[model samples]
Target: MRTKQAVAAFAVLLALAATSCDDGDGQAASGNSQASAAGNGGQGALGSDGDGTDGDGTVAGGGEAQLASVAGADELIRLISNVTTCESPSTDPEDTTFTGVDDTSSETAVGQESATNAEWGIEERATCDGEDGSANGHQLIVVSDMARFEAAFKARQEEEIAAGEGDTRTRWFVGKNFAARIYATDSEERDMLSLGTLGLNCAPGYTAPPNSTTQDALVDGCVLTDFVDA
Candidate 1:
């Protein structure tokens, strides 16, 4: 789970623009409360391997970074596809199919960007930084693989079923409360498990109360920006 901090304003966005397209939207995203800093996407972090400016212009992050811009949405997706190429196929709880990176804009918001990952066949919502789904002016941090996503979603669904719950629609969403931890360290193989989980469980659109473990974990285990920043 990437740390959650309201940007106050587009202050950081302006900053990252100057430093390529870093946008600094990822500044407070370290330590325990956040996702793997935005660029944290490694070979699979980038959308595919698009040919446009990864905001970084270089389309090349030296370390194990998710290569922000990579090429364009298509190329970025292709790159992600290359790395996450699994041999077997799995069915999801919703009977939905996850193809991969269909909606490139879901990486971040643009107020009116089109093609959300939900539109695509992803098992879970991605960690797109584009709030409203814009391709630029914001950096998108998406997950590369989907295996873990299938498990998590299915687990959540099973949880609902075991509880004799009705209507899965009201139970899941694509965001999380502050403490939804994926793992102690980066696990790309699980990819964006926490991020996707957060997306599916926290948003208001999903009517279920948040998982108590998730909320308790967040409140009991960490400090929020409001406490530090305020």
Candidate 2:
């Protein structure tokens, strides 16, 4: 899944557990990148496991809401897989200049980690499969800690340069707004469907309070903080 173009684009940039699907209008999954309002929207790559309709009428939440308590990984995947894209699609969701670091699958598949990327602490990566036993989309991954996440981002850019992915003209912008740390490959184009699963959103993007800024973009209640790695 690691391609030179996509990897180089995100050389220093980055989070979210696992995001996929979006309203890509022949473009982005749905051309809706505006992000969901709090729990109302979705992010990340939600596998086509569930559709939020449990044979009944109820909304299932992910990591940060009421739905999470009731839903499992499958439900989470479905939720992110069904969101709309941004009003206007970004220039290229595959901009790897900011997020270039790479790591093989760590194990979490795509469920919530231990708070930090290593949220499991030392849980020893487990093998998670959907209830149906079809491991097509359920794959949790281990996320890097805040410090490592930022560092790896920088390192990837250097690696890319060594490989001649882009030019020194590339730049990184750490916006003080809210945004998700999206994980994608070279050919991947993220829209709302997939973005929803990753959970890299928060009331748009805002600068974080001194304490809120961590490896992942955690918008503490509304205050935003953006960090560009390229």
Candidate 3:
């Protein structure tokens, strides 16, 4: 009886060891299979998870909608009127005193000594219509003592440049009377859309009407600090 009991106990121990080995082998194989499946799925491959992408072969990434340019000068006027102080067009406009390195033209004038030399406001100035008629171009005339605006604009330009913008050139001019900055445009003549000390001094290739003075050109029809490119 003692011998039989000992033999039974040995058999039970062997059975337990075999069960433990089988469980460990099954667990390892299951782990490897799961790891392989995860590695093969979506590892830089086109996604098939209905994620609204070209990966599912439906459509490309959602495209941006396009917008049209402002139609006429009046539309542009309406757009700007809400932001700037708009008054009846100035009957007489004078060149503001600008002191800066001009990237547009070589003409420079002595700073006007008077405080009332030029006023900063938006005026409905007449400009060429490109066809035969004339269009009312609302000119935002920026004058001296505009340090805050210039600082804000310059800071923004620097921030954009630091953020990898390589397409723009910002040139600032400082004068005793006032300072100015011109942003380059893609126009043929590299027309500038500028803000500050606008006047005949800023007008390089642009000429006023045949009978207009350099000063009256602002009111008549001139492109000093003009934003339009023909």
Candidate 4:
């Protein structure tokens, strides 16, 4: 009977050992699962694909969207018109500063095909305070066909250069479908108008070639800044 009792005790020990091992394995599996879940949570916080891109492939922040905000003529005009401190010159429309240009004019025409263009003049005393004085006024041109406009613009520049009338002192801000000829004598006013108001990026001594297309011109020297609606 004692021997039988010893054997039963040994069996009980074995069963207990097996149960302990099973419990340890289950605990380890649970820990691993929790760790995997935590890792997945971290990835989810970073982005869907572990990068800064959303599920739709767009960047998480406004980086891609802002860069893609290429403004056309209407958008450009709206942005310029939102400037409350400064007033643009207008002859026909007293309230609006936009003056319709003759599409047939060489300076206003875009390409062989017809395109609409409008000009906005910014004088030194056009601001509210009337302190931003410049010897020459600034000009903004909004065009329908930027590509064709760029081509024609280069031709005009070539003609001016050939005639020895090329005014290199004038700073130009070339956008996607708009251009700003900044002649503000005041540096602060120029910055306020070009960089602050219009959000243009200019490169000194950089001009697109006469034969360059709009894409080529933008790649070479032209800048297309972000256009935020007012």
Candidate 5:
């Protein structure tokens, strides 16, 4: 896990954006709390990646970071496709299809300038409509303005701490232009595992709740590893 303060700050930003999207008239979330920061995803500190500058720096690569002005709904789907290339083709060869990114933007929040600005990319819901799903599969939310986003989250964390409502369990893993909010039903179930030579948190052997939704099952059982690079 990264740190209590950093995770708290990230959670604050994600929670606010997710809430705004969930409540918008035209957009509907799949009722998965794990994707929300205040929910399962909001717990833990970010793990160290050792690739950063100084002590900690932005995760880089994947072309230049898209400008905040151009990081709107129009670019969201492409970004998702570019960033999310981690499907399990070896484990579940039949489920190799990556679903198209859905634009849940309401009419009032359809573009870069809308009150619900589209700089906050869309989420990949946990539930799958067809066969072949991995319990490790997790929904993702990407945002623009990495620096501002982190700053805002940090500010919110300060406010919450001052109010005596600090969350010590929030963890975050961020890269140059992307930040991911991971979810897990139980904190104890999370483990740092290795694939090939790279080590990552999130391993097998998780149990999901009965009647769990896709995202619920995912967060409950699978490793919510970070896919984007630094």
Candidate 6:
């Protein structure tokens, strides 16, 4: 009976040891699974491109340095003036040749002179040289406020249609704080001033020419804003 009891005790010890080993293995497997899941989650947070831009092209953290060195209106004007085709770019604060307003007039008068000047506190025109070594009639209007300028631009288009002026053939290349009335003498000059030197692109689902009413088509589409101030 003593031998049988001793044998029974030994059998119990073996069973307990097996159970403890099984439990340890299970715990280890669970820990490994948890670690793997955590690693996958980290990757998912980075998005597909891993450049902080999501798969759907949503930029993370406002997308730094995306404006290609254009930070303000001055920089944008410089960019326009620096076009290879531009021989002599001159800026005039009181010039109203384009808008047909007097230089001695106030901002209100300037606004009344043309629909394009409705919202600009300051309207400076920058003229550059054409391919023929003459004034190309290309105009760049630098404004104080982008929002007001865009609103005025859209309203002007509507007014033109309502008053029998037809579609304004004037193509405007707009940025964060400026607009370019593209009348370049040639395609090369137009491309350089509009998209080549400025590093601009069309907004999604929008194009130039006919769709010039919205900010997406006019400003956001043409100006790279990653460098501009919000």
The best candidate by TM-score is 6
Off by over 4 Å in 3: 42-230
Count clashes in each candidate, considering only residues at least 3 apart in sequence or on different chains.
50, 83, 0, 0, 15, 0
If ranked by lDDT, best first, what sequence of candidates would result? Answer: 6, 4, 3, 5, 2, 1
lDDT of 3: 0.33
C-alpha lDDT values of all predictions:
0.28, 0.29, 0.33, 0.40, 0.32, 0.48
Lowest lDDT 10-residue stretch of candidate 2: 88-97
TM-score of each: 0.18, 0.24, 0.20, 0.36, 0.28, 0.44
lDDT of 5 at 132: 27
Using lDDT, give the best candidate's number. 6
Name the weakest run of 10 consecutive residues (lDDT summed) in model 4: 121-130
Which residue pairs does candidate 3 place in steric collision?
Answer: none
lDDT of 5 at 13: 99
Evaluation by TM-score, superior candidate among 1 and 2: 2
Ranking by TM-score: 6, 4, 5, 2, 3, 1
Q: Return whichever of 1 and 4 wins on lDDT.
A: 4
lDDT of 1 by residue, 1-230 (tens): 22344453466777766886343434644332345543343233332335322333222233221112232333333333332332211122221112222222343343212233333223222222222232221112233333333333444445555677533331222222111111111233234332233223312122322211121112221211100000
Residue 122 lDDT in model 4? 21
Over 4 Å off, model 4:
1-85, 91-136, 189-230
| TM-score result, candidate 4 | 0.36
| Candidate 5 structure lDDT | 0.32
Any runs in candidate 6 off by more than 4 Å, and if so which?
1-77, 81-84, 93-96, 99-118, 121-123, 133-136, 168-170, 189-230
lDDT per residue, candidate 3, 108-217, as tens digits? 33232222232322122211111112232233223333333344334444454567752232232222223223222234112222222222222223333332222222
